[model samples]
Target: MCAKQDDAGAPHHHGPGTERDTDGSDRFEVDQEVQHALDRLTLLINAAEALSSTLEVDQGLRRLCRTLVPGLADWCAVDLLDDHGRLRRIVVEHRDADVTAPGLDEGLLPPTEGSAASVARALLGVGPVLLTDFPPPKDEDDPLCLREKQLFERLEADTAVVAPLRARRQVLGVLTLARTRREVRLTEDTLSLVEDLAHRVALAVDNARLHAEAQHTAERLQRSLLPELPTDGPLEVAARYQPASTTARVGGDWYDAFVLPDGAMALIIGDIAGHDLRAAVMMSQTRNMLRGIACDRKEPPGKILARLDAAHHILYPHQTLTCIYALVERLSADEPWLLHYAVAGHPAPLLVTHDGETRFLTGGRSLMLGVEPEVHRPAATDMLPPNSTVLLYTDGLVERREEDLDRGLARLRQHAAALAREPLTTFCDEILEGMAGGGSDDVALITVRTAPPHAGPAVATP
Candidate 1:
């Protein structure tokens, strides 16, 4: 016997003629085992990397199919349940050198009534599945059997192994791998490896799905909470809400505009402290309370916010909020071009003149709402030129990870200056779009452009 070193550096004995003998059968067997282990490890590592690389569902699925095909199977396909709970074939991978797999051709695939997908239904339970044995088509005349045969021919698949990609009892999708020839049966170890890969794929799919669903929900809620722009007025309002690329961070960033009972147009924008259900609820309360104060007391912009700050301190002592509340009123009948407003604990509203000049109304700074309410003061007395556009937004518009708030404000001023010639609606949307790229926070921009006296009714732009 001859001794050989294991992976842990421990000495292990090999049979006779195995020591330092390249031609020995024992050496060959050991080499084959070590090579198989390495291959399995490589496959596992690649699979994990592929799954962790992206949060996009379609992209992840496509990568998963590509990872498995031509390496572990002759063909791979993933069928996912759509919004209607019907299984839709989303990705198909084939190991053909001469031909590409079919695209999303709905006609080429049969419905999920009685198909291999039915086998995947078993995954709705616990543990992984290994369906090694499958019955042959009962009859050539059967439509289901014919469809299955056609599908196999198209992908050049023979024996198939179906695994359910499940996460926390939710069936995300089904992963199917098939061989090109019936004689190429899958070994137990190979099936086990594939099952493990399927579990990882399931987790990735679940994460992506959850993210998309959350974004969709957040967008809907944000839109609903946002006030609709006024139809008839000298004030032109445009608002846009862009969520951060990170789906989990979606929250209560909102803009509001309406004509107060005193005839002054109220423009308000605010951001809650956190990005969760708590923030959304707080935002709703704050907006409603502000509206009530504006209507009942007909208070000045500064006083309304001060009162709101006091109330919030009493209600939510631990939470914080930043807001810009401006009450716009025409200076006089003849001076339709001049508009006056106020601000509090928020980004200074930008004043963009018709001549492409941009100005920030940074009169002063005050404490954010709900923090030392009595000590905080609201800034007042800012005016805009006629036909001038005033942009009100949350701090998210000008706050970046590595950059200071001043730099963000300067960037906004530059963009607004460039877009000053554009329509108020278009300019507002463009500014938000430009500033919202590359890991920026959620942005809420409200542009109120004082329309010329002769201009038509005001319209709201997204």
Candidate 2:
């Protein structure tokens, strides 16, 4: 049977060949060839559309399979090279509805050494490989040859083409297209078209892979920089750090909770000026400096931040930072938690009572860090009653462009009051979802609820 054109103007070939004319005269060979080219072009356009359909590497590769199989080829497979240059069959698919072998579910294939498969040769970066006929199964007991024989038999492939998937002039993977009972005559023009399609697919796959790797590395570094909150005392601490969602830029927001040299605990949240790798690096530096100064000086939060303000000029000049450094101290579990904190152009910490009353702790506000080292930042004190929650956060939590800062603060207090009785993790999550969801800036928050004597030990959430 022949094919017909769909509403989208793309030819849909059921088995191959063309439908006879009404007069029963054969169509010109050149016209048939032109129709085939147009059909292949439409398929290529659809394949390009699927390139950025997903950011995941595996899903992006599989999208190529779904786009090509049953339309341009009866079978399609993608083989990618690992970091160690080993061939991994990432995707394998056929037009048969029931056939499932040689699919993505199976693991890595054997190494490509001494293999007759065109996929292996294409990976060598020489050029495309076109096989008009399937080679006879080898007599030797080589595992790859036996595997190739099995694949050929199962897919009933009569012809195949393997093209290199390259990025930055380096081979990253191989694309294989196979034909079964309805043979595809891959002339020079058709081979060139397939190679062009493979070109676009390779770039998309490479870009996705690189992006995933970079995001993973950044996450690892960010996690390493954020130390665990203390969970062994009267204080229950929960902290969260979310990168900006608007763009690929990594922000500088960070939170830290650590024990001072004294018995007191220190909580710090800060944001450097920029939103890139440099800002992230500076954020780590500033956080460490504040921690070290607090531990070594054994002073109140204000003096430690003052020291950081001075040292910031020497360590990383021409940069600005906003931070809130607070120290939690108590003689015993029976007493209420005493919070001594200092802020440098940062949002005031919120104090939520156990009974759902909420208010911002608007004391000790000062100029942003590195503005002027000579200006001494003062400290303020607040007595957080047992079962009260104190929230330290960066401005990203309550600074939206659509409204005034005061309005954002009011909204935050409203939601926080409603969620005051929830667990620390749930409390932080709900507040973030309610207030900071889809905000352009990065967010860093630390919520600590003073546990009463009856309650068990404090817990920390990631």
Candidate 3:
């Protein structure tokens, strides 16, 4: 038998200043309606506040399921449509959340055909459906509906309200609120409040989903822009990039290596100022501009960076960048590798000798790009041991908020010296694993080690 839900009881109408009709029912009815309206408004406000607490769609939905229990309904479940339009039950909660949670996690898909949980119809803009009674016993129920009926029977709920969760006129999911133990059935007024609540919840969920999708797209673009290091060369190159774990969007740290016209290999590592889509775009443009200048000009690292600095106003105005540009060349087979590089507002690269000695290549220092374009930039050259490794990295490699930059550099030097005897690829990875864990910044590292005389080509293992 269907039970009719009643509003909250009004206070006694025979108080001293209270006015009443002859039958004395008018004031009582008006007070009861006012109380019901206040309760509905409170429920709506609480639901909105709970759902707005998180930007993670699944977490928001879970909170939404839990928020509307016992006070608003005995059970609440949300079914969201996946990309391919399949209905998936993402959250299910009850008045007694712990016990009913396992049973609620059936992960069943709602029906597409003729069934009460017609998610497809709901997506097509159906407002809400209120069911007063379950179908006849012989009618088979989909797994989701069957679970709902089982919960309803267990909780002794005789009424159910299903509404579309919509945002900006687009239906994103379905919201189900069922009442049990209370004889108060969902009336028209209550259904209207349910629809409003569903609308607010949908807005939060949609915002979170859009953010996740944008991050995914940005990361894919980031991966595509990063180049693979060469496996066989006079200097074996290994690289690693680890984005900040705290943010969803990709950062602007990048590394590039290409063979120059003079048979010398050029390596560049840079980081732009921000960590969003605009920063990523600027990073790509700056990298490409540097590549063009580096290749076409056939100049030393210092000159190329100077020219890039001069062009910064036209290319990326008011932007800041830190970069290390270096050219690796060996004149003859008998001599050691000659390393010539220039730096602009970047952390000094590290040189770890085969004998386990480590020092930062601190000689090449200049104002960062875009700081003073016409300023004369200086270049530095070092005679690297045949088996020595040079690491060109972004500032994230040796920067921490808690310590001084000099201290972080000293720590990195010590670690590099300890791992100097390992293979080149392993050496690079070990340094990254050690340093990249604690920071909330992007890290880009390029490690190049001159091959020992007649040594086989070094493999790119990163």
Per-residue lDDT tens digits for candidate 3, residues 138-256, read 44755545655665676556778888988877788888888765466776667788888888888888888887887778788887788877666667888888777657557789999
| Model 2 pairs in collision | none
TM-score of each: 0.79, 0.69, 0.79
Clashing residue pairs in candidate 3, if any?
5-184, 5-185
Worst 10 residues of 1 by lDDT: 104-113
lDDT of each: 0.73, 0.81, 0.80
Q: Write the per-residue lDDT of candidate 1 for residues 231-296, one digit (tens) a residue.
A: 766677788877767655567788888887666888888888777767777888888988887788
TM-score of 3: 0.79
Ranking by lDDT: 2, 3, 1
Clashing pairs in 1: 337-386
lDDT of 2 at 6: 100
Which candidate, 1 or 2, has the higher TM-score?
A: 1
Off by over 4 Å in 3: 1-39, 101-111, 114-124, 135-144, 147-158, 183-187, 240-251, 313-317, 351-359, 383-389, 396-441, 452-454, 459-462
Q: How many clashing pairs in candidate 1? A: 1
On a 0 to 100 scale, what is the lDDT of residue 186 in model 2? Answer: 51
